[model samples]
Target chain A: MDLATCLKKMELVGVLAFATVDSDGAPQIRNISAIHYESDAIYFFTARGKNFCRELLEDGRVQILCYTKYKEMIRMSAKAYAVPEEEQAKWRDIIFEEQPYLANVYPGDTRSIGIIFCIDRAEVEYFNLGVNPIFRDTYTLGGGTITKKGYNITEKCIGCGKCRTKCPQRCIEEGKPYRILQNHCLHCGNCYENCPVKAIVRE
Target chain B: MDLATCLKKMELVGVLAFATVDSDGAPQIRNISAIHYESDAIYFFTARGKNFCRELLEDGRVQILCYTKYKEMIRMSAKAYAVPEEEQAKWRDIIFEEQPYLANVYPGDTRSIGIIFCIDRAEVEYFNLGVNPIFRDTYTLGGGTITKKGYNITEKCIGCGKCRTKCPQRCIEEGKPYRILQNHCLHCGNCYENCPVKAIVRE
Candidate 1:
């Protein structure tokens, strides 16, 4: 799936698990549904006094993840910042209107205590397990950059095919230097660990 | 629910979401089922080369969470450390015996690539949304300290009953200093924000 499809899937899932680092340096997570998705960004609401809000304000780094029923895992990593003062109300109203249940938590004027934060740029990872041998890809929203992962065979290859034999997905191909099929790789590092010649390098 | 009950519930759920902070301080999370629970501790397995394993090794702080079908949210915040090198194989074998599917991922001696980690101290929070007004409580396992949360009315309470009127749970009681029923509190800060006297303090 592409960037837009990933965003659309997250919208369809509605609620997602959000992870953030607290002031004490421990990881904290909770399920949040108060979100308004944009083609290139995501806006969510949290009370100003809540720890979730404080964490976001102090350190904007956050990760939003969802595991769909079809065994697709979508994760977005980005820094979230509160909307500009002038546009907070506009975005908050849009979210509250979309998520009616939120009214019960912050009725009427109480909603003013809530703040809206936006993720304008993020690295999104799409990993699907429903397909045999699995499949994974990375995409960037806005200007976020993708982090390279998985293993690659180097020129140090002896062509012993040891990496191919140990690969759970059997994704390694023989040549002067073995080739790893990136799309179907599990990134489990089985081949990397078993390579007799240390010819594999992590990307 | 008590600590044991919460642990048992997590065991029944099989797979749970684990959140951690990577080297870059970005939040990372994944669903893991390779777990074994004890009366006051938890043991789990992860491959040594995976990012998840690297994060745990570098920073032991972690949060494990599971949301049940009955709208119960159970979260455990703790620092996890790799089991003693001498005992690693013993725990890993026990986990593999309990979780047969793991054999498919690391068959035969390849399992040696995995490592076991233990969480012997933790503060567990149980929050249930199935009940009206909600319910929440905290428990410590293996002497982990609980971090105080929610708000409390101080002697500055004016007896105006304004906090009570605004409390969604309506759990505040009339007194010289209004008392907040901690167990039933949503910790949403509605009363704290609406209090005219500003008598409420976060616990």
Candidate 2:
């Protein structure tokens, strides 16, 4: 529903899938749970020698995704960076304290080979499919910006109701321009492609 | 355990997370379930206008990930392409037949707007965290080549057994030049980082 609720849902989902681009421009993904969540940011741990670490260092752009049992998808798009050298240990310790299972993977001094990366700003998208028409929205954490999407009806609408009929969610309503209920829109582009007068424009 | 079995597991898991690189080289991900699987290949459907489709058209590279409840992660790294024009309808029909729920989303003629993508060759990596020492291995489907990973001990091994002690899996054996049991290896690189004689090399 909001940035805080989305972050809470991600934490409740536990392990999340993180995606990043490799040097070859190919996408790589792995499940990661060694994370410490803050009110406005997230810090996660990865071994320094791992490809996951190299990918993060070479390309800070990353996407974290989680699908809850209730069919809610919380996706965070952000750039990740290694924590400040002086603060790495603090964050790493906090994560380790939270995820005790990590101790089995890197015991004792071996943890020194690990590094902590932080995502301080992100555009969090919350998409819920559990309801009838579906619901979606974007929120910013730490002042991050969101990319505008979906379709809008222009004033050129002849009110033929073609777009409304084709809309899967039936979110379009009768008006001067035929209002599209953004909250329930699927962004499936059905209405955009079916508009007879070409009045719908992508936002 | 093998490529075929892994594919079956993914089918059982239903919706999978697909990760791709956008035109700006940033990572993007979405959940996809409109899939049809074969013994050696996979076919999936997505809207032609979605960013996921554009990314595939531009870069072809993709990673399909599914995490099972038993803690097994099956990741398929491959290149995807729009099915040939003549064959698109065939694959699309098969997928829609397999996934009846798709009808609710794109009823009647609306399904024509969707495009079918295929991955005929892939390198599948199976990591099972549900087991002790974390079993992992890679397999190829449709004659795909795999990028070797993890560490190997070279002939320069001094047999000091330091590598074995540091190995979390204890999979390294004492020998003239220590051998790493690839099947049980965690690939954490602890043995490689601590090798005093620099006998370890990444595969």
Question: Global lDDT of each model?
Answer: 0.87, 0.88
Per-residue lDDT tens digits of candidate 1, residues A45-124? 98776788888999988988877778788999999999999999999999999988777766677687788999999999
DockQ scores of the candidates: 0.52, 0.61
User: What DockQ results for candidate 2?
Assistant: 0.61
Candidate that would win on DockQ: 2
Give the per-residue lDDT digits (tens) of candidate 2, residues A1-203.
78888999999889899999988888999999999999989999988768888899998899999999888889999999999999999999998899887887777767777899999999999988767678999999899999987789999899999888887767899999899999898777888888888999986
TM-score of chain A in every predicted structure: 0.97, 0.97
How accurate is chain B of model 2, given as a TM-score from 0 to 1?
Answer: 0.95
Evaluated against the true structure, the overall lDDT of model 1 is 0.87
**TM accuracy, model 1:** 0.92
Best by TM-score: 2
Interface RMSD of the predictions, in order shown?
A: 2.0, 1.6
